[model samples]
Target: MGKIPTTIPRRQLGRRLRDMRQEAGISIQDAARLIERGAGTLQRLEKGEANRIRMLDIQALCQIYDRMDELPGLLELAKVAASKDGEQGLWWNEYSDAIRDDFELYVRLEASASKLTVYQSEIIPGLVQTADYARTLGARYFSDTSSREIEQVVTVRLNRQRIITRRRNPVEVDLLLDENALRRVVGGPKVMAAALRRLADLPANVTIRVLPFSAGFPLGVACGPFVVLDFDRATGEPPTVYVEGYRGNLYYDRAEAVAQYRDTFRTLQAVASSPADSKQMLRRLAREYER
Candidate 1:
């Protein structure tokens, strides 16, 4: 047999399937009948259970849901999920020792989001976090672990961005970082300086802005840090909000919660500096830290 690709994340297949099924408004029995599959089997797929995912099954499910664009990536991940080597976990599996189950779901949603807007309160957010910086936070805040494991997680965390950037249709990223996050010394001088420089260097598709301390506490202070995931499920797929508390991240698909966060985000943007000023701030921070 030809070698099976093993790079895919564990349960990623099921996660993607479940998200799409939920977004499409497909129920267990409805999807089962349309795909010529059993309801229990469909449930397992949606539950992130380990299973052999046939390309034909994926094709049928997508067609039933009328999601033609997702077919290619879905088929690719399915084949990898079925292969022997694919059974092995990605680098993220190591962190599962302390990571909450719901956070894993957040990671899955993050991977598939067409657009992401993050409001960071305490420190620099993960996507732009440098290796040393991520480790410092992981060691200090997360359950204790050795340096090697922390580094592995840092790698996976940074590499996960590849999912959006790699595709021909690059994901749109809007990062709103509080001014204090830039000032905080999570990893001390050297690491923080490097992280700031990296943040300033992000590409065109990625928009990084700073909510200045002068803005005087926007909506996020009460709400704290949250991630807003915008997906184009169909021609007009509304956005969703994902909030991570101390314990686990919660997915908010309810129209009311989504609407609340949406207005709050717009308020934040209006009060915060323009993109030009945001970049200027990052550049100024980098210069200050370099010294």
Candidate 2:
């Protein structure tokens, strides 16, 4: 069996192929019939879940859809999709054992996201967590996890931070952290101090705002912690909201749901401290932790 292509580009390409087929007024069954493959196979191809895709199959589909002009781009997408050795992309695949399978999709989306708006009430955002802070949380939460596995978890998180600092196209991160999150010591006073320092020294692309506990019951209070990831508009990938649960993570991409999260974020931003004030508050809190 051929290795499945799971990169974001491949998924985007598959989605584009599906859109083209639909625009040509072709049904999945008809397209599958044209290519002599099962309807499920064609469906998966369009959804980017297929373990493998053939350039010839893509060409045939394009021809059937009368979209010969799209052949070059689709073929190029096929080549890139087929280039993956296995599930490896952006380095997250290496720590698959420590991370949940379902969450990998979120990581993949995050890797390619152009912007991330994160609101956390209890802990530091993963993308910005320091190594000691991450290690402490990992050990506490995954009580049964081995030391090596915990380290691997930390490595994956620290590696993820690169997306924000990358030389080209750094992901813009907008974070609204509840005041309690900073006050709550994670690793210890020293660890908490270091983590706060890290957050304080974030690059220009990363924005942080602290929502004080004094600002009682903002719009996002009931919403809990969630992240909205926005991709490039050209890719046809809509903004996504991620909500984590005890059992699994839930993703919302529908326009209405996505809109609600976006609006809520804006409201929260209004109530949160300005960036300058937030940074000053972080410094003050760090000093408190030092004592």
Candidate 3:
């Protein structure tokens, strides 16, 4: 076991290994015995809960599963996962002390995603939040932390916005914001106004639509906030649904769960205002807030 945090590449590697093992019709216990390791250790590796992954172990498992052809890619994934320097290169890692492990995982996933479909019911999504809006939320959420620490959290959040603003192949973003998020004033009227204007003025890569109250429960129920992250197929990671909750967050990578969220998003999209109309509404709200 190693001390390094479980990373996205590590998790993907584990998932592929697990699938290969299952496809080969080998039980965990038998596979562990053949690899000269404990079943619990093999389980941890398959679950991506292992602190450190060994190349030798990966090779042994690949051999046992008769997946030699995949060894090269899996090995590469392992290299990336185990590389401390590579992990350090990520900008968010510098602020690890300011964020929770679950949040760190979310950030890593969000960074790698090629496309993002976000449905926010209350406050604005962090990726589009203005500095003041984010600072206000950070201050209350991190009430116990010092002002400097709160600032660090806010900085990390603003940095995340770069994924959509970056020059090279910026991530495609589709944001479905509930109208309440627009009407709800955060950080005072002026700050809220600025946040609305920012959303209305986002780059072409971002498509924002508002789900008005008149839509009347498009999904037939009150759905909370969730994000669907789709990665490049070359990464071998499945689409994921991130459900953020008060107590703990959940990540769903199973095909069925991801499909359900996607369908839900499409349904909401059908009822929501078009991107052009949404921007117009945002501008109108900003004017109201300015008054």
Which lDDT value does model 3 have at 127? 91
Model 1, range 94-204, lDDT digits (tens) per residue? Answer: 566444565666665565567988888778888778888888888876556677766666776777667445646777888888888999887777888888888888877
Q: Give the alpha-carbon lDDT of every model.
A: 0.72, 0.84, 0.88
Ranking according to TM-score, highest score first: 3, 2, 1
TM-scores, each model vs. reference: 0.67, 0.78, 0.86
lDDT of 2 by residue, 1-291 (tens): 122325566677777888888899989998999899999999878766677888899899888988999899888878877776545544776788877776777777887788999998888988999999999999998899899999998998998888898787888999999988898888889999999989999999999999998888876346588999988786567788999877888878778999998888898888899999999999998998999
Q: How big is the RMSD of model 2?
A: 4.9
Whose TM-score is higher: candidate 1's or candidate 3's? 3
Better of 1 and 2 by lDDT: 2
Write out the backbone clash pairs for model 1: none
Per-residue CA lDDT of model 3 for 27-65, tens digit only, reads: 999999999999999887876657688999999898989
**Local distance difference test, candidate 1:** 0.72
Candidate 1 residue-wise lDDT at 133: 87
